[model samples]
Target: MSTTEQLELDPAEVQAFAGRAVADAATWMATTMTMFGDRLGLWRALADSRPVTSPELAARTGTDERYLREWLAAMTAHGYLTHDPGAGTYLLPPAHVPVLATESPAHIGGLHQALYGLTGMLDRVLAVFRTGGGVPINAYPRDWFEGLERFSAGWFDHLLPQVWLPTLPELEAALRRGADVADIGCGRGRALIRLAERYPAGRYTGFDVHPESIAAAEAAARAAGVADRVRFECLDVSGGLPGDYDVITTFDVVHDAADPRGILAAIHAALRPDGRYLCLDINSSHRLEDNRGPVAAYFYGVSVLYCMTTSLAHGGAGLGTCGFPEHTARELCTAAGFGTVRRVEMENPFNILYEITH
Candidate 1:
């Protein structure tokens, strides 16, 4: 409708929706600013470390004070930083350390970086909207993959050791007794490396279609000192896996695969009898109505930005981010000839872990 063509509207509803729209737009732009803070080491400098004046931060970080001043002020306005009018310094609250400053599982910096990198392909993604193709995964900037590594570092470092493994006695025992494990779509190999480091008996393989990721994984494995037992290979499991394995894992990967069902079936065939498949996927509902909320919104956004597009780019089934919900997971696993499909008991809001066997 034209601007001149006014329709009857509820004033309260209009105002509320308008406010939400503006806030969301502001948050979207703030993500880029957050990337700047992360890349420029501003967050680290203020992360429960010390309060600093804009000039002081500029001097410490080798950045211009003019930009730093505006950035500091913006952060303060956004509640990421608190302004001290008396001293003209800004402080990052200790409470915000996990979400902003640190490089832990709780850190939000990775999300910022990932989003920034992914959105950089807006022109290409927009083109795909009209042309019906997608931006290739390799086309994405290094920051996207690095951001993903950082984001996943939290799960592999903290939860995988502490919660994911400990809860599964059989899998844990298998690892302890030298299980041959493959982590498909293993990205940078951090997860496999972490497991190799923790469970020395397990021989781990990291697989990915991306050559750069495979190389990076190899380097990471070497750096982590797990190179002896851990290896990284550039492989597309949608074709077939190399060997039979006691345990197979795909952490936050299936939905992004161009051929998830085929990969799952290959995984099923590749696993030894009585072997377990540990599948970590997005925790989502099959029905759209049940999937309402900001969390689901973010999931869809990332799917469009990276997951779905990459899969589509490869001419595979675009399962997107939340495409494989719990119900869908069960269906896919059952179709892949898995005898058992049980959702692992984990109190995670963002992901669901499954135990599958033939």
Candidate 2:
């Protein structure tokens, strides 16, 4: 027998590991319940309201009383809601209001939805693991894309105009002076649409591999009354960018590419001599030893389930989600023929922004 097999199992260690597994499982279930509550408007109905029976909440949200009661019971048991046993009523604490309300900037309910959506692809991910292949981006259900877009909207809405753009005065000046801008891997084009509205003088174009996303982006541009200034196309940017843009932005896209290097090279070639490139990627450490926290764990899980798999599907280098650290980013930019790479001074929990010049 192997040395590991010959070793005796310690009951205490086994119990501790099992206990952690149980806790993790409970957390997963709680997240699913959170998603359900968010999707059904249960949380919103309970927000800023007095403690009341599930029937009252059901009436407020136009849902079935019986179902709502069961859901409320589950939530109460999980400590997501407080139960008044004497009064037979439930309450969503005021402190939890911001985190659950859809319109609130502190809302993290979309993360639960995203986790649920990602778990739905477990079977496909398992098949890929065994067969040395992967599922394509478009193969996943629409909910995954919707959840991602919803989660990203808060950051883009709150940061782009207020914090991100203002940090770079030169880029802002060029943009104001009617520069041509391109957004690569612009899923649904939220950022592009926002930029178009903020800088009407600058012509904006968005490129995405998924036809549905490009179509949706085009529709959004039209709805926002910037269709004439902003356009979207369905194309793989790793092959080549279509225009010599004065500015190019890639938000959380490089590590997920089939050929990140190729995309970088294409961007370098497509940029004007004095143009700038902005890349927002996951904030991570290059070494595994330095990545020992909840955020890192979450990122690794996402990389395995989505980012790495999608890249592998295209026979591309799977950089995983945490593969592009600051050092690695600088190296890649230099190799791609960028003249300068500067890490923008911005504090965000999830991402790091870099400004590149050629």
Candidate 3:
């Protein structure tokens, strides 16, 4: 037999094997969710002081060490736990608990539960796609909102105030000089409302297509006592961004758009001469190498599956082609008549800080 023919395997069989493996791996992610016991503080109890054996941890935390040991083994394999055979102890580090403990804003234990729901959503994706109908971004029930609010309010809120805020010094400076600012596709307008509160002199507008979200945003602005300076509009940015603003900001919005370029152009038009355009979104595709580490990759997959791609399919403009890199963003800005474009690091992890000049 020819060398090529001899070395070739059955493509169908190979593909079938790989397909099942992938499915099983995804299922494993959901299965891991069932063991939320460790996430809920069981591991923390074990690692609290000197490393304790599983039986002692179980007694301390009022759990069954037998099953707890199994959980520990799983977590150990996942690197969330360190097993010391010499001491017969299991430990979870502080780094692992920051995202697990409910008290912290970065607590991602709730999101881990959300991932289980996304798995179910994945099961329904094909049917929804076939019908060409989409589940709303608000499809999840009220409890999901409660969970998300806990996750988002803490994570995103902290991120914006610390990271994204500093990146806006130039825009803030322009706005202090009396420039209108619009945060297009602002969901709930948390960031926009905050900016409005800070820059009392600047007009702040938030645009989003979901009426429900817009209402919530307006209410939030009112509650924040910036209703006078802040306004919420229910509109699709794909239609076009309104112009004459000194600064326009889009946070985590571009990657979820079906037509990013249209919005980019619209934002360009909306800017005053020499205005600044700020974009903040996940640094996917562009910085995949820098971001492809395990934890980041996992969330990126979740965003693409449940957030980005689903947003487009759900009767909304989809994030097209996972968005452009920093250079690509700069090029797009230049193409849109922006004279200069720069990227900076925002407080948000793996977030792109775009500074474009018109």
Candidate 4:
């Protein structure tokens, strides 16, 4: 379909779309700051741990009671905070605090904070599209990188335990049967290090475009004492994957490419005849305007926006305004000469893992 056709709308549909747009904009603005407020302990103070009044919470936190009360009331209206009509007070339930509070490093607070930094890249989106180039990884502020580390650490933790751990035994079995693995666009080499540490018998290599990420991955491999087993190289898989391996993995990297096709084709070329390619990417299926609900829409929108801008700055292909869907990605992989693509649930809700074999 043409872009104009996709955007064409009837009068009522246009009104509904405009209304949704306004609500969406307002929703993102509010939720983007929800984590910051929570990290500052505002949510916990109003939570049901104690039966304190707004003034009491304000005094304890050394904040203004008037503003705090208003914020709490806003949360209550948004269903994040429950309002007790009989008690005539606002409250955050125990269940809500973990997600909101930054104390549980296992919680999503770290990821949310990282996302806040990425959203700052929106200003560069147009420039990137115009130039057909992308910003270097080092171009981001230092705090943004720190925020990314915070997010990546927790993300890796979840992935290893939930997806990789369960699959490791199977992966180990595959390796025991003699599988060589390549991690394409493997930033920081966390996945390669973990695999090499666990399955020393398997040959492993980490490949990425960013020299800094490769350096970091190399250091991590050395620190983990797996440098002999795993190797890191500063190469752009987007150009063409160089070596053939029995098994290949690209985690959370393909979606960031401006030309995902080029990367996928290269991956296809680099796979051994009967080798498997595991791809983990963001879930774009849950992004329908109606089904997405408020908070999810905010996160997904920002994520899509970030992917668009970051792709531009990096001088690769851009995802444009819309993030690619799993089906579209699967089709692209197939077109690149892979067969039998399938999606499996990953440990993280944000990702879907694909098992594609050549």
Candidate 5:
């Protein structure tokens, strides 16, 4: 055989490749179905419930039986639900309730919704790939912001006060004593509001470049009866922060900034001499080889579709999602005039918390 003919793919290898491709397609479809279930309250209805026929689940959720039947089949086939062939019913197992129910911290339904929204930006993202720029934050679908709010709620609600704050004893003490605090890139202002509610004496300010997010944060503060203590402003800290604060926080914010160093510098300047700086960002490796796994894949995907693109739109350095790992974080903090950078001993799958001091 000629050299070119000999290089042809073996039948077994071709079959394996095809099988992998099919499996990936199935996984994609499963994710779509997961989002559908989340949006329609199907998962919520199934949680903690006994095995039921599709018609029964449909009736409970006020959805069409035909659609429910297909959805249930898809969920079962994808192992999201357990199928009882003998009883002709389906159920979300007790073990899976935490992963499906919104009330549970382990629920991942928000991520499914967020991914669905991110996929909608593919057309614009494709243009950026061909051209040399990216889509702006405002150009994305409104659902993207809404989905992000949902996806991040669990962290702020469950982890912030209970798990994360206790890890920083000094910061926690200051918060209780009514320290002036500021949260940069405070999307929707939930974190500040939560803090304000817990530490009623503490005054809080939140800043975000997005006006809509600022407005939403304001509304949330009002609704939570913390507006007097927690106020949000639409400001780009890349220029500089206006007020000195006892504590400043940036939650998954730096990587998306047009000028991360400038933001860090601003934070350094805005903090009091003995103030604390809390940074909650993605946990990944500075080296690409060490950043393998599903989490890394998710971060990279989001970086391309959202984080990196938003920065590029602002003519930024575009650090991307996994840009600031522990090493880079320490380096940036040091350059920004912070004297110390300590990684807090808080274990979280999606984020790493840092306590920085000058």
Candidate 6:
């Protein structure tokens, strides 16, 4: 067979693969449009699932009717909205409200906004890929942090109080009776603030290396009226965390640590003998091939763009996003002198909660 003929086989497969690739590109465009709708409050306008003409939607959202028409047409085509061409009206399906409009667990608005932040770092990440350096946390924009907070809000609001604490009855009792709590690597102090609100008797201190995050946490604490019981400090805990905490918690912090082992050790040291340490890290497989589906894809993508890069920039082990899986976590905890490391049974796709003790 000629070389050209050998290479030119499987035209059907090539076309099919190209179609899938084109669909993937269209998904990105859809995400951008979704972001636009979110920013414009178009989703909120149609949150009641009301069918409205382009002019009516424009009146409600203060958007250009022509742009709204195009967006409505696109979203309708994408099956997120229903169109009544006979009446020249469009409506957001009621079922889509939670996923499209509100700040629920199902909402993707934060994810969309976060893409803005991540895509902004594409050039820097590309350069890092070539130069063998990594992007630092400070290089990321405010939108990144804000979007992350929004994305994680549901967990702090619902899961912590209802599911996580209730499941840990002993810790729940300790918190109720005014336990000394420390949230290391606390971002914007959401978890601690939520804790303070729920358990007013508890004294909470939050520590982070990011000065801006510390400030934001403090401000958030004040706004939540938990400032009296909650305090935030800007500190690097990789060296060691200083405190005799009855309950120490780290939310999605370990995988991105510059010194994961050192931080784990510090956590063990800082906790009182009877103290309990609650760690929430990524829920992933230790093996590369075992990690399948969209969540895993997102983990690897984020690992490259943000988590791993930032850690490496700080001269860390750079375990990447999926670094600390269950086995690795248990090993590290055992190495850190944590006598007991019990994995909390949480029905979550993205996180694993560990209840550790000395």
Show model 2 residue runs off by greater than 4 Å: 1-11
Instruction: Tell me the deviation in Å of residue 222 in model 3.
Output: 4.3
Off by over 4 Å in 3: 1-31, 34-92, 102-117, 128-169, 222-225, 285-300, 311-321, 345-349
Give the CA lDDT, 0 to 100, for residue 48 in model 2. Answer: 79
Q: Write down the RMSD of all candidates, one decimal each.
A: 1.5, 1.8, 5.8, 6.1, 1.9, 1.8
Each prediction's Cα lDDT score?
Answer: 0.89, 0.88, 0.68, 0.69, 0.90, 0.89
lDDT tens digits, residue span 166-278, model 1: 88999999999999999999999999999998889989998998999999998988888889999988989888899899999999999899999999999999999979999
lDDT score of residue 136 within candidate 1: 86
What local lDDT does model 1 show for residue 308? 93
Candidate 1 vs candidate 5: the TM-score winner is 1
How would you encode candidate 4's per-residue C-alpha lDDT over 1-358 as one tens digit per residue?
9887898668898899999999877766667657556556776565455555677778877888888777777666667777666766666677777666534435665566666666666666546656656655656544454455556665565565455546645544676665688998787787777777666888898887767778888888899998877898888777787668888988777767767888889888988887778777766662466336544555455544565556766565766333556767767887998877877645455666777876
Indicate the worst ten consecutive residues by lDDT in candidate 1. 1-10
Give the poorly placed runs of model 5, Cα more than 4 Å off. 1-17
Better of 2 and 3 by TM-score: 2
Model 2 TM-score relative to the real fold: 0.94
Lowest lDDT 10-residue stretch of candidate 4: 286-295
Clashing residue pairs, backbone N/CA/C < 3 A, model 3: 163-347, 243-270, 244-270, 257-318, 258-317, 258-318, 312-318
**Model 5, 1-358: lDDT tens per residue?**
8896879768998899999889988988998999899989999998875899988888999999998999999999989899999998999988888888656678787777778788889999999999978889888766777778877888889999999899899999999999999999998888899899899999999999888888999999999999899988899988889879999999999988989999999999999998999999999889999889778988998999999999998899899999999999999999999999999886677899999999
Q: Which window of ten consecutive residues has the lowest lDDT sum in model 5?
A: 101-110
Better of 2 and 4 by lDDT: 2
lDDT of 3 by residue, 56-110 (tens): 8778888777887887777677666778999888776767666564446666655
Clashing pairs in 1: 258-317
